[model samples]
Target: MIDVLVAGGGPAGLAAAVHARLAGLTAVVVEPRTAPVDKACGEGVMPGGVASLRALGVEPAGRELRGIRYVDGVRRAEAPFRDRPGLGVRRTTLHRALHERALGLGVRIVPGKVGEVRQTRDSVTAAGITARWLIAADGLHSPVRRRLGLELPGGPRGRYGLRRHYRLAPWTDFVEVHWSGQGEAYVTPVADGLVGVAVLSRVRRGYDEHLDGFPAL
Candidate 1:
């Protein structure tokens, strides 16, 4: 039996496993997906988050970000970080780095999905594995949360985010936020020759539809 069993193999789950191992506990992560998982996100690790990752001995390969820039075609504003710089890393790169670190720390990763969770006064069991504690890092629509009756009521509709990568050199070190009448577009340099653009808007639209408005991009 392990001391900690984590559901999901995403960043949170892997991080939990690493922390458990640091605390001298045997931890295992059960995830349905394989390593180097990709997800749609801004993919920007802020300064504090970068420090946290460093503390876990995870330094992913990516571009160093200076700060943020807001542009509306006419007006432009920029803010540089005062202390540590942020990182713009791809989801896959970040995942692979964390996965490697977890493995090096003796965190066992099992391949399976957690269905029903059973617990006793001293132990918790899921996916036929028993542990002293269970961590539900299953994400937004977490099955563990639902099965444990911990899910909260649905809230109002939220904005949708879409991301796409372009094979182009970065124009600036600062992350660019292009504000439009409809929504905002976040542009970050993930590598020396790659730039990721993500749009957040209330209305669901294709990448081309959103990019059409940002001619300067």
Candidate 2:
């Protein structure tokens, strides 16, 4: 039996596995997706988050972010970090780095999903593997949470995000937030020649429609 069984292979799960290994515990991560998984995200790591990743011995290559800028038409506000700069790393890059770190630390990553977990007084069993503890980092709508009846009641309508990348030189070193009545668009430079744009809104609409709202972007 392993000391820890992680129910996903995303950043959080991989980080947990690395932490387990650093604590001298055996960890096994079960994930159905392949490595370097990409998803819709702002891809902006705050300074504290960057430090945390570095403490875990994971350094991802990306453009450095000096601060944040909020834009509303002609009116805008900017704030620079007082200490260190943040990082605008791509999601895949971050995940890959964490995955590699965990593997290097002797964490076993299995290519499968944890299904129908069963837990006793001392151990937890899932996906034909048993562990002293199980971590459910399966995401927002985690099946593990659902199976364990740990889901909370739904509140107000939640916002959705859509991300895309553009091949262009970064004009600024700050993550830009373009606000509109419909939603907000986040523009961040993930690479020297690539920028990622993510739009978030509670309203259901197409990506182009959401982008139309942020004319200032």
Residue-wise lDDT of candidate 2 within 62-97, one digit each (tens)? Answer: 999999999999999999988999999999999999
Q: Model 1: per-residue lDDT, tens digit, 21-47?
A: 989999999999989898667888889
* Residue 154 Cα positional deviation in candidate 2, in Å, after optimal superposition: 3.4
Assess candidate 1 and give its lDDT. Answer: 0.92
Q: List the candidates' TM-scores in order.
A: 0.92, 0.94
Report each candidate's C-alpha RMSD, comma-separated, in the order given.
1.8, 1.5
Looking at candidate 1, the ten consecutive residues that score lowest on lDDT are 151-160
Model 1 misplaced stretches (Cα beyond 4 Å): 153-159
Instruction: Identify the candidate with maximal lDDT.
Output: 2
